[model samples]
Target: MKKILKACLLHSTAVSVSLLSFSFGVRAQTPQTPADEISPPVTDLLFGIERMMGSDSTLVETALEGFEEKYGDAVRGGDHIQGIAMTAGGQIVLSYSRQDPSKENCSGMLIYSSPFDPASPNRELDWDFYCETSNTDINNPPTGLGPEAHPSSLQASGNILAVGTHGGTRFYYLGPNGIEALHPNTAVLTGGRDSTGLTYNPVDRRFYLLNSDGSTAVGKNTIRLCRSDQDISLRQANQAIFTDSDCINIRDVYVSGQGANLIVQEDGTLFLVSTFSTRDLPDNLLGFADDNTDAIWGAYGTRCALETALLPGYGFRASFEDHIYISELDFSNRTADLVMKRDIRRTQAVQTCVDKRPAFRFAGGVATIRNGALLGLWSGRQNPPLLSLNDSYEFAFQDLPQPIKSASVSEEKAYLFRENNTYYRYTDSQGVDPGYPASTSRNWDFDVEGDDKEILGAVRYDNGHVYLFLEDGYYSRLEKDGSTSPGYPVKITDNNWPGLAPYAERIRAVINWGNGNIYFFLENRGPFGGTLLGDGEYVRYNIAKNRIDLGPRSIEGPWGILGDYDTDITAAVNWWNGKAYFFLEGGEYIRWDIDTDETAGPIRTSKYWPGVSDDEDITAAFRHQR
Candidate 1:
């Protein structure tokens, strides 16, 4: 046996199984060590590797206990948070303006030693060291980002921290010593265009911005997607193409606020947040982008928002008034909670207009980080896969739609079902029927409950009606007029169908071969009784005989095309076009040549269906020939 044996470290997904085999003396060896030095045995080394790979530790974030008071202490009259970002290591960076109306003013950035304990902040740094005022020293690099500075933006991805100013975007390297500015040569100069809100996308390796439309007159803000990392100009920034029905000027100038910020998700969905809003868009409007069509920020843009940050597992956090909200993605004011509130009066409380609201101290700018990086997003994964042609009418599937559970085709329309009784009435030429992807009602007069309608498999039989295998071993038939056929939806029993009664509850898909036969694929229930490796099998029934003729064969053995995924077949469709399709888990389907019996593909459902995610599986499929 070669010392470097297959059973040693070559386990694909069965590392534990191999280890057990090796320990039982199937082929155990001591193995090699680093530098030929004495080291632990093979078991010890492999166990260490397993422990390292299975590590589930995450960065522990401290509560923002004293964030508000700390903000009041660091800032004085007219100072407000400008931008904020967090590194992958949970380090925080904040930028703010110290511009007092009476003075030239100053703006500066601060780096916190993560989970930001305001009491200590960064152990190595002091607030007095970075912020110098124009009143005291105008020429020297005294404090802040320089005298008379208006606003600056910060973005941290992994160890790379970037700052945006009129001089352009400056990069920084974060080390044990703290953040150090990179050389001017590495800086991406933006021709004095101070990107009010700056973010770095790790996936695309580019910087994105939130800036005002050249007309500061209207104060309209538009997203600037920097095409070139080094050159972020107007031409490169303007990439928005609105829908035909949308009001361009309204959506462009919709959301306006101080210290506005932006955060993009991995799939190109972004949120444009603001500290406070005066004109346009509501509050926390969701933003959508069409990267495939080069149409960005069209209609799905948001309303009012604050500095926002997305944590890996804890979801998004946004501060409003005094409370911070957390949700999977819900930034809406209605459902979001942390539903706390507090307000501090600045100066003296006076009557009428004299009592101007103080600038919001929290969410000045928000960002989340991991692995010492920005944990960037906007990877350009288009969910809708929306496309536009020479323009008659453009169409695409809705984003993140759930996968269909079962489908049946008729002469004119096809019916598709999802969980929660949602269904889509689809068509071939006109695409999906309007007012579909709707929910089916549980108002059926049958004794069956609501869940009993969930379709497990479906097929348009040799008869004129469509047959549906429903939940709880029940079945139904639909007429051409979209109404349930009379006296239908009965439970499956050995009396009606002989051999199928035993496996009726396990049927995953039902198909009509069109040659006077129906076939069924019963789903595997996991190694039968939990002891055997019992894979599911397909059964063939003869419509002429009204009974199962030949069946109970191993799915993988008969259909060599299934490979190692015999138990994973969720749906089967016999296309009217001389092809049979087998749908598997995770939106992948293979084409079977009925005549040749050779498999053509394991193609992605998204490749043909657009909106289906790779993780969404097809439960059942159908097609009927008139």
Candidate 2:
């Protein structure tokens, strides 16, 4: 058995039932016919149970009376909705598990026409034509062999409808013309014991199925990929195979004997969620929520039924038992956080049974509509309701403890090195506090030092590592977490090459071009300091070879313009467009072309870039593309 980790929301609160109650109105009526003999209503009225009929006879009767009054005409005696799918055109396709099996026309699937206005009391459904079986001559009837066949899951893409049957190995596709068997008996990818979930990826033009034995054990569940050149015939061609070893453990969560569901976003990111775990397949293992009780006789025997929906902006919403959780997924970190959670039971007296335990069985499926509203289906004696939630977790940037000395940015996050050798990371949306502190080990002891170890510059390379240049002619390579790389603080002295020894202590500035080259500015501050020694030299540090090239002698030619400034080279930054700009002491700057090894200007910074003040001195500058 795999260990189950509880990943509940950081702050759990009660959802307001009053808002849902106002949307769903109850009706009064006593069913005169048997459940299986009744026909589905064609009106726009909201149907289905809102609350469960607990052991309390008085409460159950009162709830039943309200349902009878509002939806008595739409309620079928034994009609139990199993699955639902909504199309882009606003059409709703519903599957019933306990439809009248005797009716030759009872296909267990119904199609509700569009313009399903929740405010309208007289909405209409196409009750004459079912999804699986239609009386019309143009559409074909369901291809299943038995009348007992019931749909377990339903999914829609454009006008195509994909239906999975309970306890059946094959899935069915319903189109404008008719219904057909999606998988043949000889197909390579026969669904598991029961096909619980089905989804279509428009990008790849393929269908994905979640087949499992209902065990939350590793390797007991499988995700089958179905593909076909034609729209009608689907064949199992492959399984969701992961290249990552950590993702291999994801199959364990599906082993739990509960129905599982899948959702594929427009970006081809696949999400699989079961009662045991929610996984962003191929890598991330989003932990599970614990709502199970020790009592077997409780409203929900063990665990809560689980379902997930992909909201806009990459937000993931999960409905586990009686609580709804909203989480933001960080694909870079391979982790997700439960940002907000709402427990529906807190606001409803009808949520618990006579035993006072929450009855999760009364809850139904959750679907996200085009307008971003969540429609929930419930069963028992009350009417289902619509819930609208603001599930977005906006990132808030926190103030840094100290001013940033130098900063570098990666694809997913920004790194800020503070004046105290402490570093923090800023995501595209928010800033993080200080992480691992910078390393203290030095390659050589400083001769003139009084605890003021200034960080001269910092840069993030193309290879994802960061380098921090110190004032003492030494540098340290830092890991993404800000910790010093092993054997760091390498001295700038050319001990291995003998060429860099002369300018070792005279190194004044450094800048990483993001490519494989790190450019160093060496100034000859005569023995007494402040005395200019000709034009300072500029050298290119070969990052891969870990050696400085002395053959070029120095940056002569167009680069020799920097030699005029001598020690006045104040700051340098690799701009977003890939060019390096060197700022001089008098607010004058020059653009260096990394590719051609040329200089563009001795232009005044105040004239070209007004944001940079001439009198204002900058310690360091770096590129940050958030």
Instruction: List RMSD in Å for every model shown.
Output: 22.6, 21.7
Off by over 4 Å in 2: 1-79, 99-148, 166-189, 193-195, 202-205, 214-250, 254-259, 274-363, 366-626
Model 1 Cα shift for residue 510 (angstroms):
1.4
lDDT of 2 by residue, 1-626 (tens): 00111111121121111100112234365312221111111111111111211121111111111222322233343333444544433444545443443444434543333323221212232321243332211122234322123444444443444444433333333433333333334122234433344444444544444444443222244433333332222322122221122121122233222223444444544444332222211111233233222222222312222111111111222222233333222233444343433333311222222112212232123333332222332222122211111111110000111111133235455333333333334342433422222212111111123233555565666665666666666666765544456776666566742465555555556677767777767664444566545555577777788777643234445366776665677556676455777877666778887677688777876565523345444434454532
Candidate 2, number of clashes: 23
| Deviation in Å, model 1, residue 360 alpha carbon | 35
Worst 10-residue lDDT window for candidate 2 reads 391-400
Best by lDDT: 1
User: Candidate 1 lDDT, tens digit per residue, 1-626?
Assistant: 00110111110110010000112233254422111111011111111112110011111112222333332233343343444555544445555444333444423434233332211221222211123232322122223323224344555544555555544444554445544443334344432333444444334444444333222111434433332242222111222211112111112332223334445455433344333312122132333332322222222121111111121111222222211111111212212112211121211111011102122222233343321111111000001112211101100010111111233234656555554344555576765564344434311222274233567787877766677787778877766544567887888887777678877888888888778888898766555554157687788989898889887777776778774777777777777677787778776888887777888668886676543445446565566665
Per-candidate TM-scores read 0.35, 0.31
Best model number under TM-score: 1
